[model samples]
Each structure stands twice: as C-alpha cells, then as structure tokens.
Target: MTFKHALMAATLAALVGNAFAAEDRMPPIPADKLSDAQKKSIELLSEGAPAGGAPRNVGAGPWVPLLRSPELLNRLQRMGSYLRYESAFDPRLSEFVILLTARDWSNQYEWLAHQKLALKAGVTPAVTQAIAEGRRPTGMTADEEMVYDFIDELLRNRSVSDPTYARIKDRFGERGVIDLIAINGYYSMLAAVLNVAQSPLPGGAPQQIPTLPR
Candidate 1:
C-alpha cells in the first residue's frame, strides 16, 4: 500500500479500537463521585444472591448503568431475585428463556452472559446454537419445546394464542406460566436497556451476536 493509504488505514483502525474500548457509555462512577443513594444501592445490590449472585463489584453489566437510578435498581434487582431464583421453572428453563429474550433483542451482552448459564443449567449446545442462528432448535425435550414455543410466539406476536397459553398452563400451572412470562419480560427489559446503552461485555470480550441487517 502507498504511504498515505497506510496512514489512513492506521488511523481508522485506532478509531475503531477506541470505539470498542469506550463502548459501554455508562462506565462506573468513581467511589468519590457516588451519591448517597448510589452508595446505598450498592450495599443493597451486594447484600444477597439477587439474580442468583450479586455482582462481586456493582460496576458490572446492567448494574453499572442501573446504579444511576438507585431506587429503580434496588426494586428491579429484587424482582430479578425472585424471578431468577424463586420462579417455578427449573434453572435450565429459566436460562433458556433468558437466552431467547437475548437473541430476540440481539442483545450481545445478555447472550454472552447467559449462554453459558443456560448450557450449565443443561440447555443443550445444539439447542443454543439453533437459537443463536434464529432457527427452531431440534432435539429439545418435550418441556423445552413447550417453553420455547410459548416464548417464541410471545416475543414475535406480542401475545400468546389461547392454545399456546393453555399448553404451558396445563403443564406448569398458572404460577409456572406467569413465572415463565415474567422471566422473558424481565430479560427483555434489560436487553432493551443494554442495547440502548450499547453496553459492552466485560474486559472487552468480543461481541458474539452479529447485528442484524436493517
């Protein structure tokens, strides 16, 4: 390449690198700059296994930006605690719902964070791969397929059909059905926030979900 062309390319690469480095617009507030409410929120967030375990540091993932609205964060985290840990669905199913929401929103951070949990919770690699690729996963258990179909329809149509709703309700009971929907909705909201903030994965980890064509 010509000298001028090489220099231009070098500058372009630097800009891209900086963009990735600074992708998380809501970087953590320094301790000194934290407001009283923000400080209190940190305590509440760190107090328990909300979302199965609070972040070791309050500055991670959705928590970083969420810390800005301390009361909201506190409330949301409590709700998440119940939904994630106390909900009727099994861990595998919970993570599966979360992954579905993440993919539906194309929220890379959520997918990156939960895909492992889903697998560890026993969601099959083949199932996750299919979800990641926007295809219907094959070989899911009868229960997994039921949950998948219910969530898939809900996300796509913004409403579940009577038959779909009845199928889930009959298998899991009303509480189970609600818990399933709640998990999907909760993650969907988080995904929206993360996507709007363009939240970056921790430690500059590479983004896994490709941006869909507009």
Candidate 2:
C-alpha cells in the first residue's frame, strides 16, 4: 500500500478504537422505539417527578432496564417515591443513607444525583467526603452517628448488632426502624441496578464517587 494510504488507515483505526473505548456500557433505550410497557413506565415516572421534570438520569437510569417488567417498575417507583418523599425520616437522614449506599456500590450515577441533595438536606461536607473516601466521618450528630453505624454494620455484617439495634429502636421506634431498613434496602437495590447497567452520569457531569481500593 502507498505510504499516505497506510497512514490514513492507521489514523481511522485509532479514532474507531477511542470511540469504542468511550462508549456507554449500556446505552439507553431510544425514546422513539420504546415498547408500550416502557412508555408507560416513563409516563408514571414523569408524573411523580418533582416539579420541573423527571430527573435527567431517569431516561438512562435503572428505570430503563426495569422497563422490561413494567409491573415491577411500577411497584418500585411507588416504593421509591414514598421512601424519598414521604418517609418518616427527615430528608437529611434519608439522603445520608442514599449517599452511604451509593458509596458502598461505587455507583457514580447515583452519587452524582444525590450528592448535592445530600448537602442541601444538611449532610455535612465533611461527612460526605469521608464516606466517599471510605472512612468513618468525624463530627456526626448523635442521630447521624447512630444511623451511620447502623447502616455500616448492616451492609458489612448483613445484620445489626444487639446494641446497635437497641440504640436505633429506642431513638426511632419500631416504625422508624422499619423505614430505615426499607430505605437501606431500596437504595441498595438501586445501586445494584445502576452498577449492573453501568449507568452514566448526565452529560458533562463528573463521577463524584471514587471506587474504593481493595
């Protein structure tokens, strides 16, 4: 082959390689081609979305894969709505649990969505930073510390210790305890969905959660 032709071919090959490397792990299902079930899921999600619109990530988020089973998606959406908007725990505490779950899963998209909300809901910067770095945060309020410890143990040990259970039970009551566990389980499920799908952050967003070193 001629030298010029060889160089051009090599350059084209390099560009294709780069594009493939950067491609999304799970590309979102295109809106135009959605199944009836998928379309219904979007409609339900849009209805419940906070005032302006559905979250940017919803199109690419777990909801997409979940579209395969609209019934399951519907139930999850209702449960998620309650956990996020109507839970007995205050927004701050709810957001804290979300961040913890996001970090545990190394879920970049979940972290990107919740990190700011977590701050707005009053989780301190120090605590968020520490969680992102896989360390126990300093200066937690009594309630925050109890929650952090409870979730940490639950995730690591798969069950709370007697003392941890007693402490939370005393402070939050039986219903609150149930809600806490529900929130943890719900968000953990979301983390798994996002991780499995390799969901991407919204355009131009950076990955806020760093993967922890083994």
Candidate 3:
C-alpha cells in the first residue's frame, strides 16, 4: 500500500477495534444521533479547546464513554480545563503528574495521549521512559522529584506523607498543593472510566506501559 493508504488502513483498523471494544459498554455516539444534552456537553468541551485541538466527537478518548453522562462530562471538562491549563504547576510538571497517573493505571490510551504532551512540556525522554517502565525516573528536577514522591505516596499509601505534603505546599503554595491533589484525583478518575470502558489506544497503537504484576 502507498504510505497514505497504509495510514488510512491503520486508522480504519483501529476504529474497528474500538467499536468492538466499546459496543458492549459505552459505545461512541455519532454527533448526529446525540441528544441535546450530549451535544451541549460536546460544545462545552470544545469551548476552550485550541483552534485545532482534539476532536469534538463522542468517540474521542474519554468523551466516548463520558458522553453517556453529559452532565458529568460537562462538569469534568470544566474541572479538567482548570487542572490541565491553569494549574499552579508548570505544564511540564502537570503533564508529568498526568503521565504518572496514566502509568499507574496502565491506561494505554491515557499514556498515548499525554506522553507527547509531557515531552513537549519539557519532561525529558529519559524520565518518561523510566515512568513507562515503572521505575523511579532518574534526573527529575528537585520539584519534579517532589511531585513524583507526592503522587507516589498518595497512590500507594492513600495519603501523602507529612514531609511530601510539606515540600509541595512550600514550593507551590496551598493552591499548588490542592491543584496537585486535584490533578491526581481527576486523572485517576478518568483512568478508572477508561479502564472500565476498555478504551483502545488510537490508531491501533500497541500498549506502551506494561501491566504491573500485582
């Protein structure tokens, strides 16, 4: 096949796979078929999106399943807009937290979506690769390390240690601390939805993060 043809084929295959995966659960609803509330949710999701950002379709990432509950989807997009774009942490650190949450959840779609964002936001390739492999990434800056430890302890222990909490609060302020916690919780909630939905990675990409042995 020609390169263009090959790419188209891959995309079609991926769509087919996603259809099969989502049909029994929260299947993608076509725009034309969406209810008024669902359409509103899509509109809200698109309100602040960049000129050429992610698709406004129900099939895009978490929106597919989330569309089922338009109010939830709308609320989530509002909250996510703040956490993703206006969070106290730098974009690099925000994306690093997102990637870490994705890794922890083994959510392939989440990882696929944010890995590039993480890199583009200034997270080093080495750090991302280490996180993908479930290792303590070396070379993270002091702040990055602190953020990592904060989330790591929170996820593993169900609460941040006193020291970890203090470090982030000192560095980023109480708002930063709250944003940090909110980002983790927010992404984790999305991960749970995607996991329950068995959302496939876009374009038939192979899973990047390995499932932990448990």
Candidate 4:
C-alpha cells in the first residue's frame, strides 16, 4: 500500500482496538458539555484522519477514540504514517528530532516514548537522559553534535539561525533538514494532543513531565 494509506491504517488499528473498551463507567459530564465546534471536530476526527496538518484529536481529558470512524481515522493514519516513514534523513535524525521536541515541551509521554526509541536509534544513555531532562547534552561526539545542535536551535527559536542552518545543510543536505523539521513538527502535534488529553505516559502509572524554564 502507499505511505499515506499505511499511516491511516495504523491509527485505524489504534482506534479499532479501543472500540469495544467502553461501558457505562464512562465519565459523566454532569450536564451535556462540548461546544458544537468540538462535537463536530471530534466527529470529523473519528471519521478518519487526513494526510497531515492539525492533530487527529485535541480534546481535554478522556475522549472517544478520534480515529474510531473509518473516514477521519483513515485520513489521520495516512498523515501520521507518511511523516514517520521518510527515507531521506538518517532514521537517527528522526529520533533526535522527536527526542528534542519531547524534551523541549516537557511532555512526559513524548519523552518517555522517545527515550527508548532514541537509545535504539543509537543515541547514548547520557545524551538520551539529557535530552529527556531538557538539558543541553554535552554528551555528543563532535560529528553527532551537529544533529543535536540543529534540534536545539529549533527548540530555542522555532526556526534555525544561519550558521546552524548552514551546518545542517552541509551535513544532512536539503531533504534531511526538511525531514528533521517535519519530524519535530509531527511530534509537536502529538505532544499537544497528549497533553490536552491528559494522556498519561504509555504505561498506566503516572509520571511527571519534567519542569523546564520556558
């Protein structure tokens, strides 16, 4: 299948997985809540996700699976998978982008999920810990610092300075930089959804998001 289609399928799987998991124990709203916009958005989100742009869902607290509906879920699944399945950038760079944003945002779930992925991506433990803690890791090798610095620059400015941009260009070439940016943007969207939804870290136990100076 095509890249977009594959991504949508993944989200569809997550949504379908949860479809039968509800009961009357579902949380009460006291009085019916949700503005009309939110209700419609939620419905659209579930109908199938699109190919990138906005999060699949961004409601506060618990939510019906946004991808439960085949249409919306399929659209988002495509976007999520397409962004994640790039081939030009070194996969390690993708993980670094994810780790950097997760750390910058002080998002516990994002950090927790990416930490292992970072390590598996060949990032050292010290560097992974530093990234997870929002500390500028002095742990990178000279060659490796280029990627870390690129992520750090983006986290700081939400855009790159000329010198950093030049270095990234030299190292990763144009496609790599674009992929890196997309990687960060993709995770940023995820962090927003996870935070607003109050989704805990992947496992059931609660963990605190690290405090950042902002």
Candidate 5:
C-alpha cells in the first residue's frame, strides 16, 4: 500500500479498536441538562437545519462536544448552513469534498452520514468506493478531478500547490475557492469533534467505510 493508504489503514484500525471504549469520552448532553447557552445553540442549529428539523439531535453527534462553547456552536451552525445550502459549487461537488474529508479522518459518523448524501448528489459509486479504498478514483470528469486533487493536496500538504490553486481559482474564482476551503475546514472540525466524542453510527447502521490494507 502507498504511504497514505498505510496511514489510513493504521488510523482506521486504531479507531475501530477503540470504538466501544471511546463512547464515554464525551457523553451526550441531555436536554434537561442543557445550559441556557446550549439551549440557544440548539435553537440556532435547528433553525439552520432543514425545514422539518435537524437531521440529528443538537445534543448528539459532534454537537455534543461543541455545546460546551455555545457561541462557537452558533457560529459554526451558521457557517454550516451556508456551506451546505448556499455554496458556489454544486451540492454534488460539495458532498465529494466532505466525503474525502470524512475518509481522511476515518470519522465513522461523518462517513456514514454523508455517504448517502454523496450518492444522492451524484457522486458515483466508483468514485466513493475508490476513495473509501484509499485510491484515487477513476473516470471522474475534469471538474471532479480538479476538486479531488485540490482536496487531496490540501489534506496531505496543508496547502494547495500553485498550479492546483490557479486551476480552481480560474474555474471557480475567489469566492468558490473560499467556499471550498471553508467546507473542508468546517467538516474536518466536525470530524475531530465526532472522533473525540466517539460518536457511533446510529444503532445498527453498517459502517460504510471498510478498513484499508495495513
């Protein structure tokens, strides 16, 4: 396996092994136990979610840890609203970036939640599967390839190379690039929260990402 693949394998193995034990690291904040600030955070988060209600409880998932800082949670929720619904890129492209971020972090909750949305957003099975397997996906359009490369370089290097930057900037312009980076950074933060929280997939939901070759 390549270095990236090997690293991913190691990370996944560690996370999988600790899955059960990590649960207590950050327990959910019960509604009755929520501070006034946390309640306000939930209200903002819920409003930013879909019209019906938030996909998951604000007291659950990554939101649990973030609840400790209600102001931060509120800001994050607003940023998340824009990235998810109002970004310059298409929803499919946004989802692609999120999936790659999810995989890089080996964040089970992130991967599980976005896998279906990625598919619905038209990220092909081949691309998602290849990413899950830690290989560069095949048969992506120029746009997909550009997005993949940009995200890949950013994750691996902490900055994009000049050529990659120019290509995306030319095609997407400054606002698009900013939005792209924002999505990646935001989701990565959420991944960290989820990882630390040891948030599991809902009940019996199967893990979508497989363990990579060690």
Candidate 6:
C-alpha cells in the first residue's frame, strides 16, 4: 500500500471505534445517528488522532495498541470506575497520578487528557496548571497527597517503600492499597506506551509542561 493509503487505513481503523475487539469492528456509525455526547466524543477523537503518515519504530513492537485495545481498555476503564466507587482517592487523585506518570515519561497527549479530566473532577484550576507545568500541585487534598507521594516513591524505587506502602495500607486498608498499586502500574505502562509511540497531542494542546528532573 502507498504511504497515504496506509495512513488512511490507520485513521479509519480508529475512527471506526473499538468499544470491542478491532476484529469485531463497530458497525458503521453515521454522524447523524450519534447522540450528542457520542457525536462529540467521535469528533474529538477524530480530530486528535495521529496522521499515521510516517510510522516510527519504537521498542520491540508498536505502542498505541496497548492504549486502544478493547480488552485492555475495558480492564483499565474498570480501574477508573472502581476508584470512583470504592476508594479514598477521588478522580482528581487519579488524575494527579496520571499527570505524574505522563510527565515522567514525557507523554504530552496523556497529560492533555488527564489535565482536562482533573479539572472536571473538581481539581482546582491552579493545581491542574501546576501539574501541566510539571510542578507539584499547590495544595492537593489529603488523599491526593497520599497518591502523589506513593507515585513519587513508585517511580523512584519502582516499588513503594515499606513506610509509604504501610501508610497506604493503613489509610486504604488492604484492598485499597492493592488497588492503588494496580491503578498506578496501569498508568505507568500507559505512559511508557505513549512515550514510545511519541503520541501526538491534540492541536491547541497545552505546551507548557515543565521539564521533570532526570
């Protein structure tokens, strides 16, 4: 296939939606057929997807699939839902960890999405701006403080220190701590994928993230 043809195929594959397996593609979704929310989602993703014009080689294989694959996507989305229902940390805390992971891996697109969500989740505008700028949030709540500290430990040590883990264990009890680790690890893998893919950020995406320390 010509380069242009290949790029078209990739974009169409994404635009087609993968709410399930890519093999079991979504039926043709007409613009007019979509509800307002669904239509807006389609429009945003369509506008932001990479051009696919010149694919780059990274690591041993491709990276975007790990982000878009239905099985993994379902599993990961469940983590967000579970957090929303069962945890001390709110979605804003989740967003804080996501921003930390994205900044750590230099993944611009990840930062963009989570920053927007963090704000919507009631994270203060100043904190989102701070996170986007790669600085600490000015005053994260108690739960956010726990999450940020845990993430800082995880990235630095690749595992939380006994002290930090013990704190989370006490704060969240056993299951919550485990879920916290699972959630952070999930985002860590995601950040690595976006970094490896060199995922393109949306146009008008914030370009102001600070440079994380090496």
lDDT of 6 by residue, 100-190 (tens): 7777765655676667777877788887766555556767787777777888788778888888888788888887687777666776777
For model 6, the run of ten residues with the poorest summed lDDT: 53-62
Score each candidate by Cα lDDT: 0.82, 0.79, 0.82, 0.59, 0.81, 0.57
- Candidate 4 segments exceeding 4 Å error: 1-65, 68-73
- Off-target runs (Cα >4 Å) in candidate 5 are 1-21, 48-56, 211-214
**lDDT value, candidate 2, whole model:** 0.79
Question: What are the per-residue Cα lDDT tens digits for candidate 4 across 90-155?
Answer: 546567677787776666666665567668878788887666555568768654687777777787
TM-scores for candidates 1 onward, in order: 0.86, 0.83, 0.84, 0.63, 0.86, 0.59
Candidate 5 TM-score versus the reference: 0.86
Can you rank all candidates by TM-score, best first?
Answer: 5, 1, 3, 2, 4, 6
The regions of model 3 sitting more than 4 angstroms off are 1-24, 50-58
lDDT of 1 by residue, 2-53 (tens): 5446545645664565465646677888999999999999988778775447
lDDT of candidate 4 vs native? Answer: 0.59
- What's the residue-level lDDT of 39 in candidate 2? 82
Report residue 195 deviation for candidate 4 (angstroms).
Answer: 0.9
Over the stretch 1-214, how does candidate 5's per-residue lDDT look in tens digits?
6767685776677577656544547667777988998888787776646533235566456887888889998888778877887788888999999999988887778888788888998999999988887789999989999999999999888999999999899999999899989999999999988877767666656666754553
lDDT of 6: 0.57
State residue 86's C-alpha deviation in candidate 4, in Å: 2.4
**Weakest 10 consecutive residues, lDDT, candidate 3?**
49-58
Output the lDDT of residue 73, model 4: 37
Better of 2 and 6 by lDDT: 2
Q: Please identify which of the two predictions, 1 or 2, would achieve the higher TM-score against the true structure.
A: 1
